[model samples]
Target: MRPRKPALRPGKPMVRRGVPVGSPFRLLLLGASFALTGYAGVRLLADDWFAVAVWFVGAALLHDLVLLPLYAVADRSVVRGLDATGHRDRALYVRVPAALSGLLLLVWFPLISGRVERRYRLGTGLSPDGFLARWLLITAVLFGAAALLLALRLRRATKQRPPATH
Candidate 1:
């Protein structure tokens, strides 16, 4: 005789064919996301599909071949430096701002560097000359804010420490 399956208890996920089914709300969100993705794919393919395909492939290759290794090395170096200085726990203070600044730089490189100033001006009737300065200012603000938060955390930590015996 075949062995009987165990009964499912309340709050436990339902199992079907060796797979666990997610909650109804999670499944609904998943289905909605799939539908949205399908709609976007159809719309994109209807337009200049070749350009989109090329952009996607080029982005993937660039990220895998160049960006990934460069960032990985940089991150490892930062972590190693922090660990050496006994500030490993403070690494996130540097990382978060740097990552945000890097993302902003990546997204606005042409404009930030003034390389697309003329084209941008002609297309949008607005000068793109301040992008570089604005980007620098924003980066400075991000780093400054991160430093302030780290200082506050350090102060709080020191205050909570037990008194040391002589």
Candidate 2:
């Protein structure tokens, strides 16, 4: 005699046992992306792509081993500084703009500093002369905008609050 299987209710969607909460469509998409990445990686191996592959692996390892610790320490320092000051308000305003600007600088350092001017110009047919100035201006704008928004939000919040009684 066979054991009886549990029946699923009609209204609830069928969920696989041992799986965490997530949409079936999202799981399907994740599987497809992994498959496509594996396919591309295999194709790259066939084209004598060892150097590029090794460089990518090395870069990943370097970022994990070095950059991750450095950034973590910096962030911890900032948090500690805020804690020491006893004024933690608007930390997100500073952190968000600084993080975005740092990421932009990291991504565009070579172009911004003209270190790879010839290579960049050859590849894209565009000059890299203005990159440094543009990046600085963008950094300033990001911080300025963040500061303005924080000020506005604080002002509105203050207006909405009732006055403290003596």
> What are the models' TM-scores?
0.65, 0.60
Candidate 1 positional error at 101, Å: 0.3
Candidate 2 — what's its lDDT?
Answer: 0.82
Q: Relative to the true structure, how large is the alpha-carbon lDDT of every model?
A: 0.87, 0.82
Which residue pairs in model 2 clash with each other?
Answer: none
Over 65-158, each residue of candidate 2 has an lDDT whose tens digit, in order, gives: 9989987888777777887898576567778888898899899888888999999889999877899999989999999999899889978888
After TM-score superposition, the amount by which residue 136's alpha carbon in candidate 2 deviates from its true location, in angstroms, is 1.0
lDDT tens per residue, model 1, 48-145 = 88988788788999899999999988988999999999999888998999999999999999999888888899999998888998999999999999
Query: At residue 40, what lDDT does model 2 achieve?
Result: 87
Give the number of the best model, judged by lDDT: 1
How far residue 105's Cα lies from its native spot in candidate 2, in Å, is: 1.5
Candidate 1 regions exceeding 4 Å error are 1-56
